[model samples]
Target: MEGTIVRRVIPSDNSCLFNAVGYIMEHDKHKAPELRQVIAATVASDPKKYSEAFLGKPNEEYCAWILNPEKWGGAIELSILAEYYGREIAAYDIQTTRCDLYGQGKNYQERVMLIYDGLHYDALAMSPSDGAPEEFDQTIFAVRNDRTLGPVEGLTLNLVKEQQRKRSYTDTANFTLRCGVCQIGVIGQKEAVQHAEATGHVNFQEYK
Candidate 1:
């Protein structure tokens, strides 16, 4: 437990990846959008490199979607950031205990942590009070690859789940309401449901 690293909980919005990257780099989640923009531009500039085969969408559309604040970030974004920052980003998949290293440098002087539950991502860093941060790549890969590495309190799993649940609810509320049967717009959930009932149109959509 003496050498255990403390994990910081980034906001559980869809932008969790960007927020995690921002936190690792600047200790500020507010920088997430800027980081997201940088990654978006990087992907945009090389569509063929991050093409549909790898990104699951056509390069141009994926580029646009990746920059959306409501969009989530994933391995593709993480790898780009590692390369852009010239620092290793180690991702630990908690369920599988899989540790993946990103970035090209060899010295491993600086590194940060990204924790992935099967569903969400969060940032981890050495607690300042715990002493100097190590070459995390070496610490995890070389020293403790066989063991689960984290603080005694664990990886903030409950916090991660709660944050994600709250974020999901908030995101759901942002959808625009429209009646499927009447094809008319409604102001909010109340009106949408009320309209559906009045028109006997059981189907409704939350569309932009």
Candidate 2:
């Protein structure tokens, strides 16, 4: 049930909505009422700057979509600067969902899983445009999954116990006598010695 699709967000169409919000949020943070009025007007007018800012240019190495819009959401905007290959990238904005705003409910784990899966798919699709091949992008997803599920606790202790057990049984031929006080050679050596002593022979011709 895995699938992927690739498409670029048109700068003219997408950047306008995003940029309007960004402008309001960036410049009118202290003026909440004014910001809201401006946002409403911008959304009503449907400016082009919003979408353009999103897919416009690479200002930084990584861009993020800020989920919460009320606090920071304005159409589409940059939220954080991320480092990618030693370069900084702007963050993109996304509408915050009920789950993101208020936290998940009973199906929290499932919801989180879905979110992660979607992010992986999007990252794969955007990899090429991000200057990485699809194969390399796949590796990023694989590493993310690996680290998310990797055992972090009690690992050292488990490895130590396993190593001890491995060493203890390494030499199968070494055995303890019935008296538990002396070592015996291989099973054949013990049997040969038993036969010689039982028959009271000084030397039993060695059997090949």
Candidate 3:
């Protein structure tokens, strides 16, 4: 009765967060634009709730930033998407193997999983068994069902172990990046942010 839970790799098109959410919610990987619209519209409509201090930028500017397809999504976007879809989202981190549950206190009926390798997001699904194709994958699990939730968590931990064995996780704190514009090198995400803030260069590529 237990199924095989596996990681469904998503393309690194800067919208992997949206794509992974779409894959789990609708089985469609191309739902970035519409979901981005949802976030933009939601923020644009509620200025008081999503004020500049909360968003770390002006509401309008954050809205525009999120609407841009080239930008990446994080906790803010995950929380919004979880509320929008009315389901709890559990993101499993590769580096820490910690699960961050969004919408936990909201009493959502169902839950979905997303795997984070520090830099990119991917969907997690369960097939009937090993070697089963993704067409047979089940993305949603009942929140209150221990029978389902227990095994899913077990399998996800197994997958995380495999990924860690293969060194598939990124150490964002120590990873090196080079600005695509000026080719200047920076260490870690904080330094990369500082470089971007200082030079107005947004493009960066990770390098060994």
Candidate 4:
């Protein structure tokens, strides 16, 4: 079933959230920056409304950073797009064990999957009745919650595999490397090596 159901891999860049949204919406990745900017503007325009306590940075600063191509996107971006597009987005976080349905304000009658492994977002949708991938409104993607004979079952496994595949193309330096000697974790090869050298440790392992 996982093999039959289709998933789209956005680029490994920091703009993954935007790219994922664009893929699900059947838009070109080149147009993702514009979509990202739109969400940022919406947040900047109304900070108090969207700036929940979970938002790490202030609305203004977050908005500015999100516009940068190197900045990563997460719940903030997901929520903004859900509202801006007037559609429901179901996000499942494998690491955090969180599942949320956003943009319930409107009855968009459609939903899509945003798989979060705590660091990246990937788009997932049904393979369609005709077994073809086409540009269709994400709002029309049918998702069954009954978990019987639908794509929802085994979705977590599919998403986990997709995340692993995406990571294979990414630089290992972006991953968290743990020092085997001290059992301490650090991000990036530089940090890992530096920590090892500073502590006279050599062995290290990468944690995904």
Q: What is the C-alpha lDDT of each candidate?
A: 0.63, 0.25, 0.89, 0.64
- Candidate 4 lands at a TM-score of 0.64
Arrange candidates, best lDDT first.
3, 4, 1, 2
Clashes of each: 0, 27, 0, 1
Q: How far is candidate 3 from the true structure (C-alpha RMSD, Å)?
A: 2.8
| Model 4: worst 10 consecutive residues (lDDT sum) | 139-148
Residue 73, candidate 2: Cα error in Å is 1.8
lDDT of 1 by residue, 1-208 (tens): 3443555667655577887777777666777779878988998888778889989989888878777776667778888988887677877666455567777345444566777754456776654344454334122222133332334224434433444554422122244666666788776545654665577564555565
Tens digits of per-residue lDDT, candidate 2, 5-108, equal 22222122212223332222232113333433444444334434434464353322112222212222221221111110111111111111111211112121
Assess candidate 2 and give its lDDT. 0.25
Winner on lDDT (2 vs 3): 3
C-alpha RMSD of each candidate structure in angstroms: 10.1, 29.6, 2.8, 7.6
* Candidate 1 off by > 4 Å: 1-3, 104-108, 128-208
Q: In model 4, which runs have C-alpha deviations exceeding 4 angstroms? A: 1-3, 51-54, 96-98, 128-139, 143-175, 178-208
Query: In angstroms, how far off is 76's CA in candidate 1?
Result: 0.5
lDDT of candidate 1 at residue 208, scale 0 to 100 = 59
Task: Find the candidate with the highest lDDT and give its number.
Answer: 3
Stretches off by above 4 angstroms in model 2 are 1-29, 47-89, 92-208
Candidate 1 worst ten-residue window by lDDT: 137-146
TM-score of 1: 0.59
Best by TM-score: 3
